[model samples]
Target: MPHKDTQGRRDSTGGVGGPRPQEGSPRGGLTLSKPSQRRTGRGRAEEELTRLVSEARLLEGLSDSLRDMVMRAQAYLAELRTAGSTLENLAGQEGVEVLVPIGAGSLVKASIKDADKVIVSLGADVAVEVDVEKAKEIIGNRLAEAQKALQDYVARLREVERALSAYRERIRSLLEERGLAGGPEERSK
Candidate 1:
């Protein structure tokens, strides 16, 4: 005879000099181990699904930030283009009086001293005086860089969206497999 544990599972070591339980005993003792093992497997699956959903949410937030950055970059490019056009128009004018903004909706009347020279910011609070053609070139380069940055951010956002979609699909499939796909109301119970 074989020894049985408290829940009727066969002991790892049979009683000394006794016969072992048949691997497929009619008492169905082997099946008793399945419920606890299934519970463990289900718990692990739920944890993994939760983790994936959290990661997807974070990626969505990152995607939104990237989209905002792209929009800002595009707006800056438009401003640069406008500046370049204004400089071109001023290049051919002589003794042109312009209203320069001094922030806070204030403007100061100024006369162009040198129509050929324009001051271009080189970032880091640094500005340099350049001729009209050089200023236009700098603006063009800045526009190109801004466009490239916008494209890169858009691509990254698409990649994040793809990852989010994939995670959502996995979560859905796992929930359906576990018969928990009726939504949060059902899962809570």
Candidate 2:
């Protein structure tokens, strides 16, 4: 049972008819575009903004992981470079005793039998014996491929950073529009 005027017009809104409603108020005294039964116009916008913030946080995590991966890749690259350099020096030190790693932080004192030859792994636990020169060439190939792959990962990391920046920019704009908070730069100060 809704209240009605003398002319049978429904009270303001929520009924069959009313005085056509005020220009600014279609549903009631306050004008609002209801996106769903559970949320209002601003509620919907706020929800969207929240979603954007969550996505930005996820991107931040991914960025951290990517940074970790890049650091590890660089470290591995350095190790490979050191190995290559070591091989060159090792060629001159035939019959020299060395600390051969036997896993688990343990080493076995062993003498070099053939400094001109080394074992190279080609992934999947597969390895082949080759001369020092051949091993250097193989290492060079691996280094080249790793460098290229690292570059691609770095590129993807940059893209993620850009996306995160854009998300932050959008969140900042929406917050400013609603007088909620300041942008990143403003918040820093």
The best candidate by TM-score is: 1
Which ranges of candidate 1 are over 4 A from the true structure? Answer: 1-32, 178-189
> Clash totals for all models, in order?
0, 0
Q: Among all windows of ten consecutive residues in candidate 2, which has the lowest summed lDDT?
A: 30-39
Give the per-residue lDDT of model 2 (tens digit) for 131-181: 999999988988898798789889999999999999999998889777777
- What is candidate 1's lDDT per residue for 26-131, written digit by digit as tens? 8654443567668868887989988988888898899889889988988998998899789779866768798988999999999878888889999899999999
Candidates' TM-scores? 0.73, 0.70
**Which residue pairs show backbone clashes in model 2?**
none
lDDT to native, each model: 0.82, 0.82
